[model samples]
Target chain A: MSQFAPPVVKIEGITKVFGQGETAVHALRGVSLEIEQGEFVAIMGASGSGKTTLMNILGCLDIPTEGDYWIRNLNVADLDEEQLSVVRSQLIGFVFQSFNLIPRTSAAQNVELPLAYQGVSLSERRKRALAALESVGLGDRGRHEPQELSGGQQQRVAIARALVTNPAMVLADEPTGALDTQSTKEILELLHKINAMGSTVIVITHEEEVARAARRMIRLRDGQVVEDTKWVA
Target chain B: MGGLGLREVWRFAARGITANRMRSSLTVLGVLIGVSSVIVLTAVGNGSALAVKQGIEKLGTNSILVMSSGGAGRFSRSSNSNAKGLTIADAKALNDPATAPDVKMAAPILNASGTCTYGNLSSTPQNITGTWASYFEASNSPIDKGYYWSNDDVVAGRPVVIIGTTVATDLFGTDSPLNEVIRCKGQSVTVVGVMKSKGSTGGFQDADSIVIAPITFVQRSMSGYGSLSQIQVEATNASTTTAAMDEVTTIMSAQHKIKAGANADYRVLNQASILASSTTSSHTLTVLLAAIAAISLLVGGIGITNIMLVSVTERTREIGIRKAIGAPKSAILTQFLIEAMLLSLMGGISGVALGVGISHFTVLGVKPVVSLTSVLLAFIVSALVGLIFGGWPANRAASLRPIEALRYE
Candidate 1:
């Protein structure tokens, strides 16, 4: 545990396999990485190269078959499902590629969903959700249903939801994948602005433009990291 | 989220209910069919039984009847017409002070199935009884058209008779039947009076029927002199009936002079005991009906379980989303549990209402229905059905693995 320089994500020798015996798929093979707090990193890989697998492990939605992972200095790989849920809620925010908003719910309601599990009072949850929407610059549009909102506004509402719980980082899985060119740029700018505000950001995407927006990049092929690049300088 | 209380469960349940209103209505319909059958069948049985019981009670539940044991129904074990029966001697002996002065009254009845004719008004072979005027008092036969005979009419062995209301109305058209002559088996017997419509007494039709004349007159002029039907006795009240029966029995045993322990040559039956037993048998029948309907309830419960399991499958992604956002397994369990209870409670309430409605049709104009208990019972059983049948699927929903659920296609 280190103060003032908390390593937001740490993984060592993570490996994952699917199936058994003669028909095994080695989705991840001894992958290892680390990122300090407030760093914006992008993970780029082709289809079937296990990027989603690693993302799942990093987000605590899954545990590695053979590795240890620490998120914000807490050992997560050893935690059980219930404990992982706690970490998922309080530490990591997620914005899926599909937006994955519950159908027919308004943006503010979606944002407040996470805080409902946190046992926050309704008024407090409303306030925080509104503040998060304002942070993402969609405060006035909180009541619009996901279908009514444009792709960019929808992703931002999802972002506001991810941010409302004050997580250590936001995991955006191709957050701008389905958006138009302008909406993608606007979302990428929002992610940059969010990173500048001191929360770590990790993005998984196949788009070169999306990867190029990150300060650091790690590339994977055939379940192994083939390249790591730092564009910070 | 902090509290799992009834209100929150109800809220969740309301959303589920509104989400699929038609399915809810149909499910409730299944329960309604089940509960309503239980209610209507029970009410019909009870109502018919009440009608029978009221008809019997009019003769007075305290009235003790004796009939030739040639037997009546399945339980008619002791006596039949083939056996020697109670005679006018028995009634005369019972009228003795030593035998049954407590037998406030006793009617030695001799019945013949015979047609009686008056001018053009000819009647079917109805029940023609031979007894003294006190038979009306003991048997609760009231005179609506005319008066019964005096003891002089009975003792002088006059050919006078007190006719039942049915007999008078059929032959004499309800005018004063007294002093009119009715031809029975070619002999003219004077009808001294008309009896009130006794209705039915203990399964015996009192209307379209007959009453009258001394047993001596019946024995001499109608059937053989020694042959008599059974004797009926009226006790002062219910409490003394047993005592009165005891005395009558002791006297009859002496009169018939039986070998030790051969079961009395005569049989005594209590009307109250019969009424009470009918009610008991009816209760048993109701339970059997309910048990049969309970099979439907069981099927309904299973339906609830199966639907919930499908819901778990359909909402796997939602469960994942909730768990991904920090919902505990307990919360998931409660949500599914609430859904199941909502389904069953809705079914029960509707079932109760439908059951009550069915009872109206079954009651067929009768009031003070038999289905109130059935309604309450249906609710409790439906609630239990939820706990029993919904339990496995609710637990299944609650115990889902969030990690895998998130990956579910």
Candidate 2:
């Protein structure tokens, strides 16, 4: 991989230690990595592994204890909760494993979530929310709440929410973990389409099938990256 | 999106409230009861104050009366007892160039309670006051029939009297007592005039009363030969009346020859002055009640905080999803705040309705004039309670991290 390019994610000598004193656990130990913009990357690790921690750091959801992390030129490690929220709201859209839609909220409202944080006017928020849902082919079902939607439809709504802000990247953690095979395929295809749209996409999961869908893989064992590979799909 | 925040708050609170329907209702009920109580009690207090004010106004706020002080009007509240009784000397002093320049007029009153008779018809003892002609203007006493007797009656000691409405009813029915001869207190006095119905003035029926000959007749015949009882003095206007009072007090003291620190033998009193004192006391009581009512609103605010806390706990996943989709902590806080305000505003509205109802009933059972001030006070208080109480829990909701919230099962 070329190092001179504009990298979407850059980590230098990152170490994430959990707890304090002698009983502390080192979840990431001086790990360093870089991924360029528009790259579809996958992070894989078993239970107790720190792949999710690395994913969080790249997503600006967590700060590394003892290193520098840059996302689209902004330092993640130095950002406070407010700064992090700004980055999270405007730069990196997130889709969780369980299709974490707001319970009792309508699909359109869930999609409009990012715009609300952006201080969009009411009409603009509604218009953009509807457009985002329409892109996911769920326009007619905007009024349907989370529970009324299928697993696939719910994931689509989550994806719509992530895409609504036109973020620099989409950070998805186990995006298909709770879906059936059919819904899983649908979710993967949605991520694939979002990846093709020029935004960098990072998927964090332990599943091999999910990892294979990404263009590059960074595999972790325990707390260290053991394999970094690019697979032709 | 509406800054009203109520729409959003209600939308969200509906979820929390629905989860434990009975519990929420009970809590709302408690709050409602507290709110209504505040409104009701305040209305009652305000209503009573108004009645007292009206009664005082009827007695004339501008009139000054001098009554016999301690040890004089001792046995009878009606009699201007004590060594304090205003003498003809004070009445004469009212016109003195050295002292009472601002004194518009003064009525030297000699009050007598006695029966009046015409031929064979006898009436009960009525309130008979021997006063100057200026008594009509100062005390708002009106004449219904015949002209008042001239100053000749007082100067020459002519036997004549002015009769009140009650005396007219009891003695003459409706035949009119003007130009009639009546024996009063064992003296034959000709009726010269009849006083119009003054209705009730400070709980005393003034219409059914009579006025007799000057202080001389009342002292010698009516009150067992008592000295002059009281003097009513009127000032040109209510504004300069306080200064006029100072002048009167100084002159009277000079006449009575009392040193400083001695208990006054005579009491210079005014219904308007008494009313002002009563208003101060009533205002204190009102403020006290309003403070207690304000506390109930605080309790209502706390109730909102507690309920919102429970809501935050229950919807942990929702917060996670919102944050994941780029909803910031501020957004979350605003959402929760809106919900809280909405709940309280609704409760406030309900409470206002309840308050008005209670106030209305308060006046209905007994006449209480519920004014605009009381209603306005209740509204401002309730809304303030909502804002202050809802603030904390909403902030808490907004502070939750997306990751932590997501991790919540």
Candidate 3:
């Protein structure tokens, strides 16, 4: 939104190696990136391109092995597991491709989970959860469990859950990977509307159509960024 | 750390348990069996112990019995050719205050069993004890109806008798037996007093099926005055019973010319010693029953652990989802731990109720006495079992990594 504001995410040359010795696999090799606030960006990569690893680090679910990662000026590497949990609850939201809603729980309750981890009171959590569901165009489906809902409806519930915390960024890992073409279009349009509301959005995907919906595109090849471009649609 | 309050955690735990109703109920049943058995078995042991105590106490706590070792024991009469029999003279010596200071009174009893008849009714009494009036006081048999025969009755060889409740009910029916003449062993005797009902003792010996008469009359009419059967000695008080026994034994051994520590012709039965030995045996039985029940409780605890482990494994994906949504480790831990605790605590409470209810009825002819200590102990132990057994699975659930959990199928 502004050129003067510092980037919401900044990472130095970061490397992530899984295991040790000669058997160790390098998932991320000295990659550097910055993502600004209010930017709807898509990170495109094939399987094993280190995109998922980078998303994990940015979401504070993990820390870099050899470099520093800062989320809103807080050094992620310096924070412990408990502080990382707080950051995830208060600052970041995640939407998985599988719509990982807890079984036997209502959609409204699922949306309220992040706020619950943030220690929100029950009444306040309910109000915010209802508002989030309303924004996701499923206000009346709040009480339905995931099993009772369609795949698209479950994904919408997950999206509502991601947005309920008013996080700094919403990281969707192939949000429409399991959806039909019609559901994908609807989900892409919802992401557009969410981005227009001045919230930063990141969609990680291997699909060209999904990446095409974002204003900015970053492509990864072999654990390193190969292309970065801005598209005016 | 502070997000999930105790109440919220409890609700979550309750929901988790209800989600798998069949499994949870089975686990609860296991704990219920363990706790209830602990209470029931211990109560049975306590009941038998109390029954024994009551039986011995009816014999009078301050009394001691000096019987001839020539017989099978105190209850039976079998001649042993090598041993000398107890006599009336030995009873008189125990009654002397200067030689046996702790002795309050002494009565010599000659037991004879015979059919008693009044009018056309007849009944065989288990014991027809012929003794002086002092036997009534020493043996704790109180007179329920008429007055006891005087000392003059013994000197004059009077045919006066006292009948037990069972004998009175048998020979006289509802009619009062006071001043009525009854034939016992072909000797006519006047019923002077009827002893109070003592009920059946230890479910074996019938204390209310006996007849009592003056020793001189029984000797003249039935058994000849060769030797007395047993000497019933009453101490000054319960605390001096051991002293009275020691004094009687010493005097009898000297009178019989038996050396110290040698095999005497007689045996002394102290009620206090019998009480202590019986109490000790019953205590052992109680401990044994409790120990066996504890093993079942331990198995129930193991059942909890097994069920919790299965729950953790089954809910791995769910745990992953919660962790991804920013649930702290402690919250997950608390949720699972509380679920296990609720199961066991429910079982324990229900077990207590069931056990107490069962104890109200007689089992194996022993009336159970429910001890408060066993109830409290069983409950506390059950709760601890839940906490301790649930710990491993809860920790396993909590320490799971968010990324790995989310990726879990």
Leading candidate by DockQ: 3
- Cα lDDT of model 1 by residue, B15-55, tens digit: 55566677766766665666666666667666666766787
RMSD of each: 4.0, 4.9, 3.9
Q: TM-score, each model?
A: 0.87, 0.82, 0.86
lDDT string, candidate 2, A61-128, tens digits? 66778989887788776677777778888888888788888777789877876776777766788899
Model 2, B156: alpha-carbon shift in Å?
A: 8.8
CA-lDDT, candidates in order? 0.76, 0.75, 0.88
Q: Which pairs clash inside model 2?
A: B9-B338, B9-B339, B72-B81, B72-B82, B73-B81, B73-B82, B164-B209, B165-B207, B166-B208, B219-B225
Taking the tens digit of each residue's C-alpha lDDT, what string does model 3 give over A1-233? Answer: 78888788888999999999999989888888888999999999999999999888787766678998888888888887788788888788888899999887889989988888888888888999999999989999999999999999999999899999998899999999999999999899988988899889999999999999998999988878899998786
lDDT tens digits by residue: candidate 1, A95-134: 8887777656678878887887777777888899999999
Where model 1 places Cα greater than 4 Å from the true spot, the runs are A1-6, A72-74, A228-233, B1-21, B68-84, B95-103, B142-145, B150-152, B158-181, B189-208, B363-368, B407-409
Backbone clash numbers for all candidates listed: 8, 10, 0
Candidate 1 vs candidate 3: which has greater lDDT?
Answer: 3
In candidate 1 the C-alpha lDDT for residue A10 amounts to 86
What is residue B237's positional error in candidate 1, in angstroms?
2.2
Question: What value does the lDDT take at residue A191 in candidate 1?
Answer: 93
Model 2, position B15, has a per-residue lDDT of: 69
lDDT of 1 at A211: 93
What's the distance in Å from true for residue B103, model 3? 4.3
